[model samples]
Target: MDQTEKNVQTLFSMGFLDIEDIKNALRISHNDLSEAVAILTNDQVRYGPYSSAGPAEDVEMKDVTSTALVPTAAPPPYNSLPDAKPCSPKPDYGNTAFPQTNLYELEQRVFVDQWSIPYKKDESLAKCLIAATSLAKEGNHP
Candidate 1:
Protein backbone atom coordinates (compact mmCIF):
# COMPACT_ATOMS: atom_id res chain seq x y z
CA MET A 1 0.00 0.00 0.00
CA ASP A 2 2.69 2.50 1.04
CA GLN A 3 6.39 2.74 0.17
CA THR A 4 7.51 1.84 3.70
CA GLU A 5 5.06 -1.06 3.83
CA LYS A 6 6.29 -2.27 0.43
CA ASN A 7 9.91 -2.05 1.58
CA VAL A 8 9.10 -4.01 4.75
CA GLN A 9 7.33 -6.67 2.68
CA THR A 10 10.31 -6.87 0.34
CA LEU A 11 12.70 -7.33 3.27
CA PHE A 12 10.43 -10.04 4.72
CA SER A 13 10.27 -11.86 1.34
CA MET A 14 14.10 -11.92 1.23
CA GLY A 15 13.87 -14.77 3.88
CA PHE A 16 16.71 -13.40 5.96
CA LEU A 17 14.79 -12.53 9.19
CA ASP A 18 11.43 -11.96 10.85
CA ILE A 19 9.11 -8.90 10.49
CA GLU A 20 10.14 -7.46 13.87
CA ASP A 21 13.81 -7.80 12.97
CA ILE A 22 13.14 -6.11 9.63
CA LYS A 23 11.29 -3.24 11.34
CA ASN A 24 14.22 -2.78 13.75
CA ALA A 25 16.63 -2.77 10.79
CA LEU A 26 14.51 -0.19 8.95
CA ARG A 27 14.47 2.11 12.00
CA ILE A 28 18.22 1.80 12.56
CA SER A 29 18.95 2.37 8.87
CA HIS A 30 16.74 5.56 8.86
CA ASN A 31 14.12 4.03 6.53
CA ASP A 32 16.66 3.48 3.74
CA LEU A 33 15.76 0.15 2.16
CA SER A 34 19.22 -0.60 0.76
CA GLU A 35 20.94 0.30 4.04
CA ALA A 36 18.29 -1.65 5.97
CA VAL A 37 18.90 -4.72 3.82
CA ALA A 38 22.67 -4.32 4.18
CA ILE A 39 22.38 -3.96 7.95
CA LEU A 40 20.19 -7.07 8.20
CA THR A 41 22.42 -8.99 5.77
CA ASN A 42 25.69 -7.91 7.44
CA ASP A 43 24.32 -8.87 10.90
CA GLN A 44 24.91 -5.39 12.34
CA VAL A 45 21.63 -5.07 14.27
CA ARG A 46 22.12 -2.94 17.44
CA TYR A 47 18.67 -3.31 19.05
CA GLY A 48 19.45 -6.57 20.90
CA PRO A 49 20.72 -10.10 20.41
CA TYR A 50 18.42 -12.04 18.04
CA SER A 51 17.18 -15.23 19.72
CA SER A 52 15.18 -17.86 17.86
CA ALA A 53 12.09 -19.27 19.57
CA GLY A 54 12.06 -22.73 21.25
CA PRO A 55 15.05 -25.04 21.98
CA ALA A 56 18.41 -24.34 20.42
CA GLU A 57 18.55 -26.05 17.04
CA ASP A 58 21.52 -26.39 14.71
CA VAL A 59 20.80 -23.64 12.19
CA GLU A 60 23.59 -23.06 9.69
CA MET A 61 24.38 -19.38 9.14
CA LYS A 62 26.34 -18.53 6.00
CA ASP A 63 29.78 -17.05 6.70
CA VAL A 64 30.03 -13.47 5.46
CA THR A 65 33.63 -12.54 4.67
CA SER A 66 34.78 -8.91 4.29
CA THR A 67 36.19 -9.79 0.87
CA ALA A 68 32.69 -10.85 -0.21
CA LEU A 69 31.26 -7.51 0.94
CA VAL A 70 33.91 -5.46 -0.85
CA PRO A 71 36.31 -6.69 -3.50
CA THR A 72 39.83 -6.62 -1.95
CA ALA A 73 41.91 -6.48 -5.13
CA ALA A 74 41.28 -4.80 -8.45
CA PRO A 75 41.47 -6.91 -11.61
CA PRO A 76 44.83 -6.92 -13.40
CA PRO A 77 45.11 -4.15 -16.02
CA TYR A 78 44.19 -5.34 -19.54
CA ASN A 79 47.40 -4.06 -21.16
CA SER A 80 49.77 -5.46 -18.50
CA LEU A 81 49.99 -8.92 -20.10
CA PRO A 82 52.77 -9.78 -22.54
CA ASP A 83 52.00 -10.12 -26.29
CA ALA A 84 49.30 -7.44 -25.90
CA LYS A 85 49.35 -5.34 -29.02
CA PRO A 86 48.90 -1.55 -28.58
CA CYS A 87 45.65 -0.70 -30.36
CA SER A 88 43.92 -3.57 -32.17
CA PRO A 89 45.50 -4.19 -35.58
CA LYS A 90 43.73 -2.05 -38.16
CA PRO A 91 40.85 -4.02 -39.73
CA ASP A 92 41.94 -5.20 -43.19
CA TYR A 93 39.73 -3.49 -45.79
CA GLY A 94 42.23 -3.63 -48.62
CA ASN A 95 40.68 -3.60 -52.09
CA THR A 96 37.47 -5.40 -51.04
CA ALA A 97 35.23 -5.64 -54.12
CA PHE A 98 31.42 -5.26 -53.78
CA PRO A 99 28.63 -5.57 -56.36
CA GLN A 100 27.81 -2.19 -58.04
CA THR A 101 24.40 -3.19 -59.50
CA ASN A 102 21.35 -1.01 -58.70
CA LEU A 103 19.39 -2.53 -55.76
CA TYR A 104 15.96 -1.34 -57.02
CA GLU A 105 16.49 -2.98 -60.47
CA LEU A 106 17.61 -6.24 -58.80
CA GLU A 107 14.58 -6.26 -56.45
CA GLN A 108 12.16 -5.62 -59.36
CA ARG A 109 13.59 -8.54 -61.39
CA VAL A 110 13.62 -10.91 -58.38
CA PHE A 111 9.95 -10.26 -57.43
CA VAL A 112 8.39 -9.86 -60.98
CA ASP A 113 7.00 -13.43 -61.04
CA GLN A 114 5.78 -13.29 -57.37
CA TRP A 115 4.06 -9.91 -57.90
CA SER A 116 1.54 -11.29 -60.50
CA ILE A 117 -1.68 -12.92 -59.14
CA PRO A 118 -2.32 -16.44 -60.56
CA TYR A 119 -5.90 -17.54 -61.45
CA LYS A 120 -6.84 -21.10 -62.57
CA LYS A 121 -10.34 -20.18 -63.87
CA ASP A 122 -12.40 -17.10 -64.87
CA GLU A 123 -13.03 -15.29 -61.53
CA SER A 124 -16.17 -13.34 -62.70
CA LEU A 125 -17.78 -16.49 -64.29
CA ALA A 126 -17.14 -18.54 -61.13
CA LYS A 127 -18.78 -15.86 -58.93
CA CYS A 128 -21.80 -15.60 -61.26
CA LEU A 129 -22.30 -19.42 -61.34
CA ILE A 130 -22.07 -19.61 -57.52
CA ALA A 131 -24.65 -16.79 -57.13
CA ALA A 132 -27.03 -18.44 -59.71
CA THR A 133 -26.82 -21.85 -57.94
CA SER A 134 -27.52 -20.25 -54.56
CA LEU A 135 -30.48 -18.28 -55.94
CA ALA A 136 -31.99 -21.46 -57.60
CA LYS A 137 -31.63 -23.48 -54.43
CA GLU A 138 -33.41 -20.72 -52.45
CA GLY A 139 -36.31 -20.77 -55.07
CA ASN A 140 -35.72 -17.09 -55.84
CA HIS A 141 -34.85 -17.85 -59.52
CA PRO A 142 -36.32 -20.24 -62.11
Candidate 2:
Protein backbone atom coordinates (compact mmCIF):
# COMPACT_ATOMS: atom_id res chain seq x y z
CA MET A 1 0.00 0.00 0.00
CA ASP A 2 0.97 3.70 -0.38
CA GLN A 3 2.65 5.74 2.43
CA THR A 4 -0.46 7.86 3.05
CA GLU A 5 -2.64 4.71 3.27
CA LYS A 6 -0.18 3.12 5.71
CA ASN A 7 -0.30 6.23 7.95
CA VAL A 8 -4.13 6.16 7.84
CA GLN A 9 -4.24 2.45 8.71
CA THR A 10 -1.96 3.09 11.69
CA LEU A 11 -4.12 6.00 12.89
CA PHE A 12 -7.30 3.91 12.59
CA SER A 13 -5.71 1.05 14.57
CA MET A 14 -4.96 3.52 17.34
CA GLY A 15 -8.48 5.07 17.19
CA PHE A 16 -6.86 8.35 16.23
CA LEU A 17 -8.32 8.77 12.72
CA ASP A 18 -10.28 11.91 13.57
CA ILE A 19 -10.01 14.77 11.07
CA GLU A 20 -7.33 16.67 12.97
CA ASP A 21 -5.28 13.53 13.51
CA ILE A 22 -5.50 12.70 9.81
CA LYS A 23 -4.59 16.26 8.88
CA ASN A 24 -1.50 16.10 11.09
CA ALA A 25 -0.57 12.66 9.77
CA LEU A 26 -0.59 13.97 6.19
CA ARG A 27 1.04 17.32 6.97
CA ILE A 28 3.69 16.97 4.24
CA SER A 29 0.99 16.34 1.56
CA HIS A 30 -1.55 19.18 1.78
CA ASN A 31 -3.07 18.29 -1.63
CA ASP A 32 -3.76 14.66 -0.67
CA LEU A 33 -5.25 15.28 2.81
CA SER A 34 -8.90 15.88 1.87
CA GLU A 35 -9.00 13.00 -0.61
CA ALA A 36 -7.38 10.68 1.98
CA VAL A 37 -10.01 11.52 4.59
CA ALA A 38 -12.80 10.95 2.07
CA ILE A 39 -11.39 7.55 1.15
CA LEU A 40 -11.01 6.57 4.81
CA THR A 41 -14.58 7.54 5.63
CA ASN A 42 -16.06 5.85 2.54
CA ASP A 43 -14.21 2.62 3.46
CA GLN A 44 -15.68 2.93 6.99
CA VAL A 45 -12.15 2.82 8.40
CA ARG A 46 -12.38 6.34 9.83
CA TYR A 47 -15.33 8.35 11.14
CA GLY A 48 -15.77 11.93 12.23
CA PRO A 49 -18.01 14.33 14.10
CA TYR A 50 -14.51 15.35 14.77
CA SER A 51 -13.65 17.69 17.63
CA SER A 52 -11.29 20.55 16.74
CA ALA A 53 -9.40 19.70 19.91
CA GLY A 54 -9.85 17.23 22.75
CA PRO A 55 -10.85 18.04 26.34
CA ALA A 56 -8.64 20.49 28.26
CA GLU A 57 -6.44 18.86 30.92
CA ASP A 58 -6.02 21.98 33.05
CA VAL A 59 -9.74 22.53 33.77
CA GLU A 60 -10.81 20.05 36.47
CA MET A 61 -14.53 20.15 37.35
CA LYS A 62 -15.76 19.88 40.95
CA ASP A 63 -19.09 19.88 42.78
CA VAL A 64 -18.98 22.53 45.58
CA THR A 65 -22.05 21.11 47.45
CA SER A 66 -21.30 18.40 50.00
CA THR A 67 -22.98 14.95 49.63
CA ALA A 68 -24.48 15.34 53.13
CA LEU A 69 -27.58 17.07 51.82
CA VAL A 70 -29.11 19.61 54.23
CA PRO A 71 -32.63 18.50 55.15
CA THR A 72 -35.56 20.20 56.91
CA ALA A 73 -36.10 17.14 59.13
CA ALA A 74 -33.96 14.17 60.14
CA PRO A 75 -35.02 11.07 58.17
CA PRO A 76 -36.54 8.08 59.99
CA PRO A 77 -34.14 5.42 61.33
CA TYR A 78 -33.19 2.63 58.93
CA ASN A 79 -35.27 -0.63 58.71
CA SER A 80 -38.02 0.85 60.91
CA LEU A 81 -40.70 -1.74 60.08
CA PRO A 82 -42.12 -3.25 63.32
CA ASP A 83 -41.07 -6.86 64.04
CA ALA A 84 -44.47 -8.18 62.87
CA LYS A 85 -44.89 -11.76 61.63
CA PRO A 86 -44.63 -12.22 57.88
CA CYS A 87 -48.03 -11.58 56.31
CA SER A 88 -50.06 -14.29 54.50
CA PRO A 89 -48.94 -15.31 50.98
CA LYS A 90 -50.30 -13.25 48.10
CA PRO A 91 -53.10 -15.31 46.54
CA ASP A 92 -52.12 -16.73 43.17
CA TYR A 93 -53.13 -14.72 40.08
CA GLY A 94 -54.22 -18.11 38.76
CA ASN A 95 -53.45 -19.00 35.16
CA THR A 96 -54.65 -15.70 33.67
CA ALA A 97 -52.96 -14.50 30.50
CA PHE A 98 -53.30 -10.81 29.65
CA PRO A 99 -55.17 -10.07 26.42
CA GLN A 100 -52.95 -10.39 23.36
CA THR A 101 -55.14 -8.11 21.23
CA ASN A 102 -54.28 -4.91 19.40
CA LEU A 103 -55.42 -1.48 20.66
CA TYR A 104 -58.32 -1.10 18.16
CA GLU A 105 -59.80 -4.55 18.86
CA LEU A 106 -62.07 -3.58 21.78
CA GLU A 107 -65.07 -5.46 20.46
CA GLN A 108 -63.12 -8.73 20.35
CA ARG A 109 -61.87 -8.72 23.99
CA VAL A 110 -63.50 -9.06 27.41
CA PHE A 111 -61.32 -8.45 30.50
CA VAL A 112 -61.82 -9.72 34.05
CA ASP A 113 -59.60 -8.87 37.03
CA GLN A 114 -59.60 -11.12 40.06
CA TRP A 115 -56.23 -10.81 41.88
CA SER A 116 -54.56 -8.09 39.80
CA ILE A 117 -55.64 -5.46 37.29
CA PRO A 118 -56.42 -7.25 34.01
CA TYR A 119 -57.09 -4.60 31.37
CA LYS A 120 -58.34 -1.05 31.20
CA LYS A 121 -61.14 -0.22 28.71
CA ASP A 122 -59.02 1.88 26.39
CA GLU A 123 -55.58 0.36 27.12
CA SER A 124 -54.43 -3.01 25.84
CA LEU A 125 -52.45 -5.39 28.06
CA ALA A 126 -49.58 -5.36 25.54
CA LYS A 127 -49.45 -1.56 25.72
CA CYS A 128 -49.34 -1.73 29.52
CA LEU A 129 -46.57 -4.34 29.38
CA ILE A 130 -44.55 -2.16 26.98
CA ALA A 131 -45.01 0.89 29.20
CA ALA A 132 -44.26 -1.07 32.38
CA THR A 133 -41.15 -2.77 31.01
CA SER A 134 -39.76 0.57 29.80
CA LEU A 135 -40.41 2.22 33.18
CA ALA A 136 -38.87 -0.70 35.10
CA LYS A 137 -35.75 -0.63 32.95
CA GLU A 138 -35.43 3.12 33.64
CA GLY A 139 -35.95 2.55 37.44
CA ASN A 140 -38.95 4.88 37.38
CA HIS A 141 -41.46 2.31 38.66
CA PRO A 142 -44.25 3.75 40.78
Candidate 3:
Protein backbone atom coordinates (compact mmCIF):
# COMPACT_ATOMS: atom_id res chain seq x y z
CA MET A 1 0.00 0.00 0.00
CA ASP A 2 0.85 3.74 -0.31
CA GLN A 3 2.12 6.14 2.43
CA THR A 4 -1.25 7.51 3.70
CA GLU A 5 -2.87 4.04 3.83
CA LYS A 6 0.11 2.53 5.74
CA ASN A 7 0.06 5.41 8.28
CA VAL A 8 -3.70 5.07 8.89
CA GLN A 9 -3.30 1.31 9.52
CA THR A 10 -0.45 1.89 12.04
CA LEU A 11 -2.50 4.49 13.99
CA PHE A 12 -5.47 2.14 14.02
CA SER A 13 -3.28 -0.60 15.60
CA MET A 14 -2.33 1.88 18.38
CA GLY A 15 -6.10 2.52 19.20
CA PHE A 16 -6.21 6.00 17.63
CA LEU A 17 -9.70 7.34 16.74
CA ASP A 18 -10.85 8.73 13.35
CA ILE A 19 -9.15 9.10 9.89
CA GLU A 20 -9.10 12.95 10.21
CA ASP A 21 -7.02 12.87 13.42
CA ILE A 22 -4.52 10.38 11.88
CA LYS A 23 -4.21 12.58 8.77
CA ASN A 24 -3.65 15.67 10.94
CA ALA A 25 -1.00 13.88 13.02
CA LEU A 26 0.70 12.58 9.84
CA ARG A 27 0.85 16.14 8.47
CA ILE A 28 2.12 17.59 11.80
CA SER A 29 4.86 14.92 12.08
CA HIS A 30 5.89 15.28 8.37
CA ASN A 31 4.91 11.59 7.76
CA ASP A 32 7.45 9.96 10.17
CA LEU A 33 5.60 6.96 11.70
CA SER A 34 7.12 7.28 15.23
CA GLU A 35 6.41 11.04 15.33
CA ALA A 36 2.86 10.45 14.08
CA VAL A 37 2.22 7.91 16.88
CA ALA A 38 3.68 10.27 19.49
CA ILE A 39 1.53 13.16 18.22
CA LEU A 40 -1.65 11.01 18.33
CA THR A 41 -0.96 9.59 21.84
CA ASN A 42 0.17 12.81 23.58
CA ASP A 43 -2.45 14.15 26.02
CA GLN A 44 -1.54 17.87 25.65
CA VAL A 45 -0.97 17.82 21.84
CA ARG A 46 -3.66 19.42 19.61
CA TYR A 47 -3.91 16.70 16.90
CA GLY A 48 -4.03 13.71 19.36
CA PRO A 49 -6.64 10.96 18.83
CA TYR A 50 -8.12 11.10 22.38
CA SER A 51 -11.87 11.75 22.64
CA SER A 52 -13.18 15.22 23.51
CA ALA A 53 -13.80 14.03 27.12
CA GLY A 54 -10.36 12.26 27.16
CA PRO A 55 -9.26 8.85 28.58
CA ALA A 56 -11.28 6.99 31.26
CA GLU A 57 -10.59 7.92 34.92
CA ASP A 58 -10.55 4.27 36.20
CA VAL A 59 -8.05 2.97 33.60
CA GLU A 60 -4.60 1.85 34.92
CA MET A 61 -1.74 4.30 34.25
CA LYS A 62 0.64 2.07 32.23
CA ASP A 63 3.86 3.16 30.47
CA VAL A 64 3.19 4.17 26.85
CA THR A 65 5.71 3.53 24.02
CA SER A 66 6.42 6.84 22.21
CA THR A 67 9.65 7.14 20.18
CA ALA A 68 9.48 10.88 19.33
CA LEU A 69 9.57 11.94 23.02
CA VAL A 70 12.86 10.01 23.52
CA PRO A 71 16.11 11.70 22.45
CA THR A 72 18.09 9.37 20.09
CA ALA A 73 21.88 9.62 19.69
CA ALA A 74 23.36 9.51 16.17
CA PRO A 75 25.57 6.49 15.23
CA PRO A 76 29.37 6.83 14.89
CA PRO A 77 30.57 8.10 11.46
CA TYR A 78 33.39 5.51 11.04
CA ASN A 79 34.30 2.02 12.30
CA SER A 80 37.79 1.52 13.83
CA LEU A 81 37.99 -2.28 13.35
CA PRO A 82 38.24 -4.20 10.05
CA ASP A 83 35.33 -6.48 9.05
CA ALA A 84 36.08 -10.26 9.09
CA LYS A 85 33.84 -13.11 7.94
CA PRO A 86 33.99 -16.73 9.26
CA CYS A 87 35.83 -19.55 7.32
CA SER A 88 37.54 -16.98 5.03
CA PRO A 89 41.14 -17.65 3.73
CA LYS A 90 42.67 -14.75 5.71
CA PRO A 91 40.06 -13.07 7.93
CA ASP A 92 41.40 -9.57 8.68
CA TYR A 93 45.06 -10.86 8.34
CA GLY A 94 46.03 -7.73 6.30
CA ASN A 95 44.97 -5.43 9.21
CA THR A 96 48.41 -4.94 10.84
CA ALA A 97 47.21 -1.77 12.57
CA PHE A 98 45.21 -3.82 15.15
CA PRO A 99 47.20 -7.05 15.71
CA GLN A 100 45.41 -8.51 18.75
CA THR A 101 42.18 -9.26 16.83
CA ASN A 102 42.05 -12.97 17.76
CA LEU A 103 41.24 -12.27 21.44
CA TYR A 104 39.07 -15.38 21.81
CA GLU A 105 41.94 -17.67 20.77
CA LEU A 106 44.33 -15.89 23.14
CA GLU A 107 41.84 -16.23 26.03
CA GLN A 108 41.30 -19.93 25.28
CA ARG A 109 45.07 -20.60 25.34
CA VAL A 110 45.47 -18.64 28.60
CA PHE A 111 42.70 -20.68 30.27
CA VAL A 112 44.28 -23.93 29.03
CA ASP A 113 47.60 -22.85 30.63
CA GLN A 114 45.78 -22.36 33.98
CA TRP A 115 45.15 -18.63 33.22
CA SER A 116 48.94 -17.94 33.06
CA ILE A 117 49.43 -15.61 30.09
CA PRO A 118 46.42 -13.21 30.57
CA TYR A 119 47.31 -11.46 27.25
CA LYS A 120 49.56 -11.70 24.16
CA LYS A 121 52.98 -10.51 25.45
CA ASP A 122 56.78 -10.67 24.93
CA GLU A 123 58.94 -13.43 26.54
CA SER A 124 59.87 -11.18 29.55
CA LEU A 125 56.19 -10.29 30.14
CA ALA A 126 55.17 -13.93 29.72
CA LYS A 127 57.75 -14.97 32.39
CA CYS A 128 56.39 -12.31 34.76
CA LEU A 129 52.82 -13.45 34.02
CA ILE A 130 53.74 -17.10 34.76
CA ALA A 131 55.24 -16.00 38.14
CA ALA A 132 52.13 -13.87 38.86
CA THR A 133 49.83 -16.78 37.96
CA SER A 134 51.67 -19.03 40.47
CA LEU A 135 51.47 -16.30 43.14
CA ALA A 136 47.73 -15.88 42.49
CA LYS A 137 47.15 -19.62 42.76
CA GLU A 138 49.03 -19.58 46.13
CA GLY A 139 46.75 -16.65 47.38
CA ASN A 140 49.66 -14.11 47.32
CA HIS A 141 48.30 -12.61 44.03
CA PRO A 142 49.28 -9.11 42.75
Q: Per model, how many backbone clashes are there? A: 0, 0, 0
lDDT of 3 at 116: 37
Off by over 4 Å in 2: 28-142
What is the per-residue lDDT of model 2 for residues 32-141, given as tens digits with 9 covering 90 to 100?
A: 65544554344333422332223531222346577675545533322232322232243222313333343223232333221122243234444546555565666874
Alpha-carbon error at 49 in model 3, in Å? 18
Give the per-residue lDDT of model 1 (tens digit) for 15-43: 85588768766766668888777767764
Best-to-worst order by lDDT is: 3, 1, 2
Q: Estimate the TM-score of every prediction.
A: 0.30, 0.18, 0.30
lDDT of each: 0.49, 0.42, 0.52
Error of 3 at 97 (Å): 45
Candidate 3 Cα deviation (angstroms), residue 83: 58
Better candidate by lDDT, 2 or 3: 3
The lDDT leader among the candidates is: 3
